[model samples]
Target chain A: MESKPPDIQLRRLDDYRWEVPQTGKMRTRGLIYATWDMLPDIRTDQSIQQVANVATLPGIEGASLAMPDIHWGYGFPIGGVAAFNLTEGVISPGGVGYDINCGVRLLRSNLLRQEAEPILEDLVDALFRNIPSGLGSRRKDLKLTTPALRQVLRLGAAWAVKNGFGTADDLLHIEAGGQIPGADADLVSDKALDRGRDQLGTLGSGNHFVEVGYVQEIFDEAIARAFGLFPQQITVIIHTGSRGLGHQVCDDYIKIMMKAAAKYNIELPDRQLCCAPITSPEGEQYLAAMAAAANFAFTNRQLITHWVRESFEQVWPAGPRALGLELVYDVAHNIAKIETHTINQVTKKVCVHRKGATRAFAPHHPEVPEAYREVGQPVLIPGDMGRYSYVLVGTPQAMVETFGSTCHGAGRLLSRHQALKAAKGRSILQELAAKGIVVRGASRGTIAEEIPEAYKDVDNVVEVVQGAGISRKVAKLHPLGVIKG
Target chain B: MVNNSDPPKSKSGYRQLAHTADLGFRLYGESLADIFVNAAHALYGVMTDRRRIRGLECREVVVEAPDSGALLVEWLNQLLYLFDTTGFLGREVEVQEITSQRLQARLRGEPLDEERHQLNTGIKAATYHNLEVKETAAGWQATIILDI
Candidate 1:
């Protein structure tokens, strides 16, 4: 395919890492993690320039980083990761993108692929019917009162559990224990609350989905077992976010941050990079509001989990517990988290902005769930529905080199229009069916826009992270069914 | 006054631009008001086929921002907010007044009827990435990227 060469100078550091040397205004250099073969496509857009743009942010520590899935985004490139000094660094909503706390959760079940094969069609149909999906989809049966919605913003997944969505034990496997601290409901706008009132359990459109797959390969037996995976074991992956609420919060804050950037006199390489000092009132308010939205997302996924369980039960005639369907782990890919990391052999507090990236905290890190602390946090990398997904474990090297971060997924290789045009004369549903994958989508347009060819091969993306020692692959999963919004 | 019942041709005020994972467009007009109206037309065009929509309901909308660029984002975001909250999809937009910092529009459309309207895109918000709104030799033009 024809592509553009990187606009910025790239000095390769090794087989898996490239360096964008510090230039004019850059406070730190930029580091990109990708294989040599992927560099050409990575440079096809302005994402390389965006990585360098992030380096120009004030008080950025270490380097602006991009994972193998890096792609051009508004300000910070997708798959971008950066940490800033708490007192001097700035907070920008663009760093979190529009979907605050957009993440993925993996569910493991005792039923093997063979056991569910007979009912796969029915199960997928049930899930599609039970879960509200597609553009502007809402749960007519699940509207929340204003006061009730506030609790969701403050409590996240815990709120769902209390409301009888899931067990308290489920929270243990979630990031931040399913609730981010310092989230103030008052910080959220009425518009955001209104948008979120009825979207709690809806799978949103544009790349969001509920996929049923099975463990197809095991790279690490110990870690795979630790994560409750066995050969051909059935699993469900829920990919969604805080819905319209999160979008409004980011939109609302971006407007504020634009003014705040001028108020703080921060020189931005791009208008979308507008920000304010981390300690400034504007920055604090944004963090508080963003946290509230993040909580909403966590709760959103938890509610969906409940419906997913119900769907399985309807098809299998066995309850979730009987089927051994349990949450393996949940992690947010789009978020700005305040964390402590060692830089230059000195430990300091910095705000980590991970957009289209996942936290890969090493084994024994206090934040890893107690059950899996011996192995590490489970990092779920879901691929296109027609292909395969992978489960990986974080490594100590990630903490040292990349602030415990790894690639999120196979980044888009084709524009939506390109995918649509390529799918103009074909039915993607039937195409996937030929491969033994049952697919259901809210709209044919969505299915066309998301044809598997739209994305790069996830195996190649995962290979870079593993080769770089940031994460280690544990198991591979092949999709048998998928529900797209 | 334009008749609300008359079906307008799919105007050539805007054209789609390719974006890797999101949606984008470039719009043109002879005036800033035209730019704003054309931007809305383009916005709704991406969401659904405008030919299927009718000006059954008219909404008076106003927005204020720091500058023209911000005004464009706020204006389109207002339309998005309307669609998300009330399912109101505007097909015909008349810019009543527009300035560098504020805009007023009469948006004419109807509530989304899923059975009739073919939903094409779910736009999250208009973003500020390389956002532009300026006068050119041909006329006024604006570029925008919507986070989908």
Candidate 2:
């Protein structure tokens, strides 16, 4: 493990919480949820310092929080969460990340693992062929015209359903019904539009993938049943985001925010944390453009879902309806949302920034779909491709302490260079095959970089959240077949 | 003076740096203009094998920023925009003129032919995380982290 930075001091508040006291320009304290055993690894990076940095932001409420999967990110730590008072708070592009609304969607199928195991390779091949994956991959058959692309930006996943991509039922399980409000396509740049034109259905590289797996174990049978998951039942998970369009939007806004920060005299410890007040013209414009990019991401996943169903149809000759392939839930991990959270015994609207974090609204929250309102929002946590991913539910504790947020995934423990070195002279493919898992990838480097051991164990990450009472585990899914971009 | 006619085939100007969740590199050049050129080379180096690219196409690029840090990011992002939208990969970059406020360059490369070239990684964007551009005893040095 790398040595911890000496300046960061932590006091254990409880079994699963560590306190970074407010000091030196901080407006609030910093809270981190992690087991003691994970501290040595957590302290290995500058993420702890970033938590403190976030506390220093203006109008920050309660505390700056980091989840167990926390790692050093550009401005905010990955798995970081913060809430700011609407009047005095600031909205930053860094907090939402480059891949705006980068998220995951789960599709539960009626088929059993035994049924998919026989044709797993062919099934994965079909999915890989149907869904474009990798760097610079674009569909030759479905490039959107400029006007249609603008409609996609405006309508989000609704555009996909209207264009015959997926059913309206798919949107019901999505966060914000697969469309964030306040999106203005005109606020989005022409460059961003061009980048997203032909890239809608493509899964651009790096940690984005489509995986076929099965429910290996269930932690909460009632919640698992509520989520339409059963033991040994096959499932599909699509993990991606707004692609190049989002990247361009973020790049374009950082430049604008840089000047806006200076214009507004908002002090920034890091340039990446540059922002404008929530009510500022710059902030409103950014929010609008960001929502548009988020909508693009929702539509991207919707189109991919359409193809995933078609891939199954080609493989089994049974339709998606017969296979019972229905969307369980879709949640965005990287985003900022305007939420009403009670602070200091008063309810107020605050802009909540969840960077590399998932919103886990407590049971019966209105945002939770009607079907899942009793169990809370379904949170999908994807592990590294070779190991097991998890299904989790939001808890009241999370809503109270974390602005209804939880860890997104098994955060990176090793860099790409380290993973590549470790993978040397070893065939990662054959190794995974030996474990009875089938895999295909667009880039060899992406595969090596995503070696299972390169990340912290999802089991450990979920355990911390569960132990902390922030999120409750529902089920664990073991990978059977995978396609990585 | 470095030869403008020759491409940056040598790895001396830039070296990979370890970053936990992204790709990073340290660049060295004799002047700010040289570092800008090397930064573009390093950016493409992370995306694909630069050796396979040839100077078969040329494009003119211009960008402006309020300071050197933002300028560096803008310069790199412009090259990335071209690559993402037009499939134009840069093998050589020549900064014709540069200041803290503006930069103009001539890019030489060919459009990406996936069948002929080996793509290694996909970079999302260049970040301002601990970004630096300075003149040291060794001349000019820059540190950049690219989100992948």
Candidate 3:
């Protein structure tokens, strides 16, 4: 209710970290991982106050944490991470964001940039055409019956593989094998189902996009080799989520949680932070429904991957295997996963909420795919369409200090209105074209709103996390073409 | 003093508000019914070009919530569901009866014709972030943040 920013003191923990000491009703301290230079921009918004607000949540295991890419968000600041005790903690839909399991999936192609340069425009067009994008984007031909849609909610990417969208082996590189256990279709409301029914393969509007890029640099050769990424190698990144289904799920449950918060006597500082105890019926149901929506997102990405592969085939006339179109890895940025972590020297299972953050499990973790077990989980951080995105690997430091979490993407520096005003007469498409990147969007308005100036330089965000030892950079990707929805 | 016999019809309208990451709108009206109608209008206005849309058909919408705030969220989400499922965009919404607990209305618009109307953005859902409806000296006012 207060528009004025809260006056809070930040004690410098190090060059890359800051701390807000436990005070008042806060159950723990608030920790933010960002450089001193970043703090100036970060402090301009109320996200720091939000970090402190989150510390007041009951059963919060570690300090309420924020990654370097932190920015103002509804309940939790974007890039916020918090782990809560399973029995005593609460689940807030806002923590996972409205786009449940909104994530990134990368595909490695053996084709070098030189090999694809001639066909870059054709490839971009093919992708833009094959993959439905923009507002109200849907696949008219891929309509699913209610039962089939339920199976998608239950089986996730495996359902897509079974339906010939992709191969079963592709599932190995996906987080949680692309299917989270305990997802119950029965928990998903009919309205949620109806909303997602035709949206399975769509690249919905706003920041969602499909990028065709090439590995421009490599920081860790060993890890890069493991990920099948090499300098000059082509790759495709699909960024989307559960579409309308996830939105409705969060919307529906937020109302329930608002009531549940009152019913459970959980005092919410902000109404958007509405939540319930993890063991309560309301919490359990929300988790079940959220998992279902997450599965839908997984399947949605898998189907889009198939289309991306098809687009490549159409352009090259070479089989996918020959082109070496292998899935590198997929990571969900918005999600709540029950994971085991050591807290106070005790291995305890807790629900880790990552809103605008990614899981960066350390090397040798059981959850990391077998191929990547020797290294760490591959974390994808997509930047604005005009700039370079990074590939990072998890570290033990991340596991111990931040519950194995890292920044999701470049945090916004300018609001949409500001971006639009800045881009009043300039041609955004031309600006990107000058940078050797071909771009397409549903409308010019979205393009103007997403100008590169609207976001913080992702390079700085990545540098802060790497400097803090939360995640190690693996590779950098330069976009050759982009399709925005 | 202004004439009290005919109070100038308080303009019912809405305007987009600046948000760092998502979309926000502020709506105001002379009465609760006017604000509800304007809210629907503003939502559709953000999604597509309302000028291109014609009121070719109508559908009844009925929803109930525990309070006015939740009712507003439910009302907009219901419209989103209709758009996602049946491609129905509300060119005009007439509120027949509205209370804190219940809302009954008729939404008049044709199914989305991509060729005729240009969509601006896909709104996921109306959020509860600072969602509030209050009576002010001028009239009724509500602010909604949308997750785009």
CAPRI quality level assigned to candidate 1 from its DockQ score? acceptable
Q: Which stretches of candidate 1 lie over 4 Å from their true place?
A: A1-6, B1-12
lDDT of prediction 1 = 0.91
Question: How many backbone overlaps does candidate 1 show?
Answer: 0
In candidate 2, stretches whose alpha carbon ends up further than 4 angstroms from where it belongs are A1-4, B1-11
Of candidate 1 chain A, the 10-residue stretch with the lowest lDDT total is A1-10
**lDDT (tens digit, per residue) of candidate 2 on A64-167:** 99999999886889999999898889999989999999999999999999999999999999999999888787787898998999899899999999999989
Model 2 misses residue A305 by how many Å? 0.4
Show the colliding residue pairs in model 3. none
- Local accuracy of candidate 3 as per-residue lDDT tens digits, A1-485: 22657668999989999998999889999999988888878877788889988888888998999999998888899999999998899999989989999999999998999999899999999998998898888899898899999999999999999999999889999999999999999988999998999999889999999999999999999999999999999999999999999999998899899899999998878888889988889999999999999999999999999999999999999887789888999999999989999987999999999999999999999999999999999999999898899999999999998899999999888877788899999999999999999998877888888899998889999998999999999999999999998
Candidate 1 C-alpha lDDT tens digits along B1-148: 1112322333338777787878777777778888888889888887888999988999989999989988999998999888888889997888878789999889889988889988776888999876889877667777788888
lDDT of each residue in B1-148, candidate 3, tens digit only = 1112322345468867777887777778988888789889988987888988899999999999888878888899999999999988888889999998899999889988878888687898888777888777778888888888
The predicted structure with the larger DockQ, 1 or 2, is 2
- Candidate 3 chain B minimal-lDDT segment of 10 residues: B1-10
RMSD vs true structure, all candidates: 4.2, 3.6, 3.3
The sequence of per-residue lDDT tens digits that candidate 1 reaches over residues A205-227 is: 99999999999999999899999
DockQ of each: 0.39, 0.45, 0.45
Query: All candidates' lDDT scores?
Result: 0.91, 0.90, 0.90
